[model samples]
Each structure stands twice: as C-alpha cells, then as structure tokens.
Target: MSSESSKKRKPKVIRSDGAPAEGKRNRSDTEQEGKYYSEEAEVDLRDPGRDYELYKYTCQELQRLMAEIQDLKSRGGKDMAIEIEERRIQSCVHFMTLKKLNRLAHIRLKKGRDQTHEAKQKVDAYHLQLQNLLYEEGKYYSEEAEVDLRDPGRDYELYKYTCQELQRLMAEIQDLKSRGGKDMAIEIEERRIQSCVHFMTLKKLNRLAHIRLKKGRDQTHEAKQKVDAYHLQLQNLLYEVMHLQKEITKCLEFK
Candidate 1:
C-alpha cells in the first residue's frame, strides 16, 4: 500500500534536457524534437518561435487531461469532469513555472562563472604587463601620480565602477597565488613595491628642490642689499676728501 501511494504521489519529473516522458506510464521522451526549444527565448516567444515550446507544452497537457476526463465520464457528470480538467491544466501551469525557475537558476550560475573567468583574464593580463615592465627602465617613477590624485567627487563614475567587494578581489589574488605562480607573482609584486618607493622618492626630491630654489633667491636678495650699502659709504668718503683738499688750498693762498 505504501509503495503504490508513493508512486501515485510522485511528480512527473521533467528531464534535465526539458523533454517530458513518452506517456503517463513512462519517463522522459527520447526524441530530440519533443525537447524544449532552447535555453534562451529566441524572440521572447511571440516575436518568433521562442514562445512556441512553452505554449505547445501547455496545449499538449490540456489535450491529455481532456482525454482523461472522457475516461472519467461514466463515473462523474460532465460538469465535474470538466472542472477536474481545469484543475489539471492549473497543475501543468505550475509545472511550467517550476521549469522556468530552474532555467533562471542555471542562467544565474552561468553568468557568475563567466564574470569570474573574465575577472581572472583581466588579472592575468595585468600580470603580463608587470612582467613586461621588468625589461624596461622605471617609468611610473617619472609619470605623475594619477592614482594618488584621484578625487572621489571628481571621479564618481570611476569610483562606482571600481568599488566592488574587497573580499572578492582578495580571493582572486589568493586564487592566483595558489595556482603556483610564485615566481611571476613575486616579481610583479616586487616591481609594484619598487614603483611605489620610486614615486615617493621623486615627490620628496621635487619638494626639496623647491625649498632650495626659494633659499637661493633669499640669499641673492640679501647680498644685493649689502653691496648697495657699501657703494653708498664709498661715495660719502670720496666727497669728504674732495672738500678737505679745497679748504687747504684756500689756507695756503691766504698765508
């Protein structure tokens, strides 16, 4: 009794490939044509054949239930049988809803995998760039600190695009590290470290140069003031000597 009840209660499971079974007594359809059209709707069903598969399914199940109502005719009145058919149709609708939910879940998973793969590709390309930089002379040291100057208000769009979960980025880096990329990874990291130090040194040197230039200007001004004072004193002494010589000449003439 228990086994029979279980079998009766079991759902008519839709196969993984989207095809229903051959008949009420069987499992899934073997032929490919009976299978669901595709993962994506070609033109959202009405535009083309995209909706054809789902609706075709509904019509098929409706016909099947109507046949079953005919079988139930002698046992129940026409009205009651028709009502039961209506209920069966509702069940088919529920089944299709389940299928849709499954498909939606699959699409989400696929999308996530694709995004992670692309993110990994982006990181790999960046690592390759770092490796290439190893052959060239230091450049970012001379290049302006564009990253440091990033103003959040001025670059709101950029910040929005870049600001994802820090944990996700860390996980990706850790994943890369664990993949036995030790040598290349270390090299790229060392280069980044060097780049940072280089930029800091350049900034410091620029600041020191400005200070030295300002001090040189101040010293030059002070030297100019001293020279002007000396020149004024020399002129005053020459004038006094000339005045004395004139006075002595006058005295001699009087004697």
Candidate 2:
C-alpha cells in the first residue's frame, strides 16, 4: 500500500506556487535562459571550423545585397542614396587610376620626343660643320687659282712689247745699209780726178762720207736702243714668270 501511494505522489517542483501554469512556465523559462546561452556557447566553441565559411558567406551576401541595391537605384527606387554614394566612390577610384595611367603615357611620349629632337639637333650640327668646312676649302682653292692666273698675264704683255720693238730696229738697219753703199762708191770715183775736178770730187766724197758716217752711227744707236728695249722686256717677262712660279708653288703647298 505504501509503494502505491509513493507512485501517486507529485514530484518535487522548482516553482511550487500554483498561480497560473502560464505564469510559472514563464518564470521557469527565464531561470533557464543562461543555460540555453551556455549551450549555444559550447556549440560555437566546438564548431570553430565553420567560422571561415561563415565569413565567406557573409561577404558574398553583402556583395549580392550591394548588387541588388544598385539594381534598385537604376529602377528609380527612393532608397538608393547609399548605393549612389558607393558608386560615386568607385567611379572616383577608377577615374584616378585612368588619370595616372594617362599621365605616365604622356610622360613617356614627351621623353621620346625630347630624345628625338636632341638627336636631330646633333645631326644638323654635324652637317653644318661639314658644310662650313667644305665652303672654306673651296674658297681657299679659288683664291689660290686667282692669284696664279694674274702673274701670267703680265708676262704675256711684256713678250708682245719686245717683239714689236725688234721689228722697228730691223727696219732702221736696212735703210742704213743702203746709204753706206752709195757713199763708198762716190769716194772711189773721186780718187781718179785732177785739179778742179779733183776738188769737186773730193768735196762730194767728203760730203758723202759724212752722210755715210752719220747713217752708220744712227744704225748703231738704233741697234743699241733695240737691244736695251729687248733686255727690259726680258726682265719684265722673267719677273712675271718667277712670280707665277711662286704662286703655283703656293697652290701646291695648299693641296
């Protein structure tokens, strides 16, 4: 009978006040909240491997949410101000990258152009120096040639003058020869006469001889004049020849 009674008795209760079952159930629920929290802590500690997966999922979901927000903004939704600000930041970052790339390209192009310009300047300078050197060489040759030509001209003139003077002297000598022959014949005829004839002949002979002597003297004087003129001409031609030779030597030296 005692064993049957023990089976029918109520078990020991944590909340014995029987106000309403819902109220007691609420109090007991509050009392066990820490235990529920402790059990969750134990599960989280035991599942540390899930942390990386959770982080990855969180990131993917955030990206998806951002994409949805962008779509909503495009469709003219009212809650797109945040999305617009985020897009503006991304656009600024892309714009700055593009600007930096463009600046680097421009700098490279400028450097290439500068190098090309400098190379051209060097080439031009070298060519200009070569041209100036050639011009100077040409001028030197021309000046030397001019100097050489001038000396020969004076020599030619002198030779021509000598020839003319020689011709005139020969003409004078022929005239003197004719006069001397006539005087000699007159003297021979006067030697065979006597008295008044002799006197007249002698007078004619003396006159003829005087005229012959004058002609001979005139011939000698004319010959001497021609010789002196020729000497002067030879001297002038020699001077010119020597000068021309010197100029030719100078030209050779230049070469």
Q: Given candidate 1, what's the lDDT at residue 167?
A: 38
Please state the error at residue 8 of candidate 1 in Å. Answer: 31
Each model's backbone clash number: 3, 0
Model 1: worst 10 consecutive residues (lDDT sum)? 42-51
Q: TM-scores for all candidates?
A: 0.28, 0.26
Write model 1 residue lDDT over 76-146, tens digit each, in one string: 87568667767677767757755764575466346445545554566567655875795475554321244
Worst lDDT 10-window in candidate 2: 188-197
| True-structure RMSD, every candidate | 21.9, 53.6
- Candidate 2 residue runs with Cα over 4 Å from true position: 1-70, 139-255
Error of 1 at 37 (Å): 24
